[model samples]
Target: MKPENPLTIGIDIDGTVTEPSSIVPLMNESFGKQLRYEDCIDYNLATVYGISDEVFADWLDKHGERLYDVAPVHGAADRVLRQWYKRHKLVYISAREARHLEVTIKWFSRYQIPYHHMDLIGSHDKLAAARKWQVDLFLEDRLENALQLAEALSIPVFLFDTPYNQGTLPRLVQRVTSWEQVDALVDQLALEKANA
Candidate 1:
């Protein structure tokens, strides 16, 4: 569905919109020391710290559908997302499987998150989707996701600052650790859309 003069906002799941980066820790605990310290999501999912790629993919196949069980990030970030829906079109893009689509959508509904679109994709190339949407701003937690979006020319990814995403911030991205910061971003984006 198209919106009338609505600002397109692309949002990432997992670390960006959710809490504790569930998939990574789950993969690490399941696969053991194989999946280590890799900031990039796809790479880590394919291999484990230079170990066997088969092991990582095998592990991902098992618990990949349980992504919705991952805990949420603290604060009223969902409130911010919902408020933005009042004025803009939010596209929730996740690197998850189709099996978890219903669960993911329910999770958002229970959290009262308002969104216009949702795409449950695998660990494939995400930049393509971001570019296809012509997203004005992207919000995510994974550094690799931010970088990919940035590289795809999707500037100004609103990152949810965390330990995993610290220090190595990209030049074209912005970070926000608190709900207040997200609120500011929502309001600013809303105003811009309204004015335009």
Candidate 2:
């Protein structure tokens, strides 16, 4: 069946909209370690950096806003999101805490990223926010979040492929390699909805 007009699209900010490796430079600079994006086999930077969760949390407390401040936009996200903004309800549902909301908004503004609404739920579990927004579809980069959202919500989720997120996905979760692919998928969904 066709979805409602102006479909609410739940979008993750860090790895989905920004390059998955966006924090590498900050990490490398702070830890004095040279880590490539390929080296990040786990979603947890604490594991990748070989630090305790507490230490990692402290570092994030210090540098989290800065990290978001300088994160680069993922490939073609600005253009494609702008296009989608014309027709869809773009709702950025990020795990970033409310404290970082100002920085996040500034980052979006600095990059000219379009959005109809944004929420920084401060946790990795995005199911609540997604459901609250009544998202028809979701875009994500974390395998766990994508899986949970799809399975629980019974909504299609586009998972942005990353070195850390390598895994088999369920039927409702599709691994997308680029924003271009995401755009194509969105277009296909729109066509399907139209034809329905």
Candidate 3:
């Protein structure tokens, strides 16, 4: 079956549109430990940093605002998203706390990244939001989220490749290294949907 007009695209904020390694410097500075993005083998920061969940949460409480406010957008994300906004419904769905919505919106405005909707779900589970929006495709950075969403929605998930998410993916999940590749894949998917 063909997708509807103005295909709804569910996108992640932190590591997808934003630089995947943006938080490494902040973590190192805050924890007084040397850690690299390449060293992040798992999605859990507590596990990656060898800290308890409570300690990690405390650190975030102290510095999460500044860390998110200054995070850089990924290369070509602004340009590509602006173009996509004209033809597709760009819905940003993130696990960022709802309290950060103001700063998050500010960041988007500061970078001038286009979007039709934004949902700060405060949890890693995004299937609810994806289903609510009827998202046709998902762009993500978390490996498990991508796989889960693909299985739930039976839709293609373009996972922005990062060290934490490096692993084998399901058939519906594709690892993408750049926004340009994302653009190309979206076009290809749209074309296929159109022809189908």
Error of 1 at 113 (Å): 1.8
Candidate 2 Cα RMSD (Å) = 2.4
TM-score for candidate 3: 0.95
Off by over 4 Å in 3: 1-4
Model 3 clash pairs are none
**Residue-level lDDT tens digits of model 1 in 1-196:** 5445677888887766676455566656665644433464343445434557776667667765665656565577687777778768788877887778788878888888878888777864678777777888888877777877886784677777765666666677778877678778767776776787
Error of 3 at 87 (Å): 0.3
List per-prediction Cα lDDT, in the order shown. 0.71, 0.90, 0.90
Which scores higher on lDDT, 1 or 2? 2
**Where in model 1 is the C-alpha error above 4 Å?**
1-5, 21-52, 192-196
Q: What is the lDDT of candidate 1?
A: 0.71
Residue 107 lDDT in model 3?
91
Alpha-carbon shift of residue 135 in model 1 (angstroms): 1.1
Better of 1 and 2 by TM-score: 2
- What is the C-alpha lDDT profile of model 3 across 1-196, one tens digit per residue? 3336567899999998889889889999878889888999888899998899999989988887898899998989999999888888899999999899899999999998988999999889999999999999999999999999999999999998888898888899999989999999988887877778
Candidate ordering by TM-score (highest first): 2, 3, 1
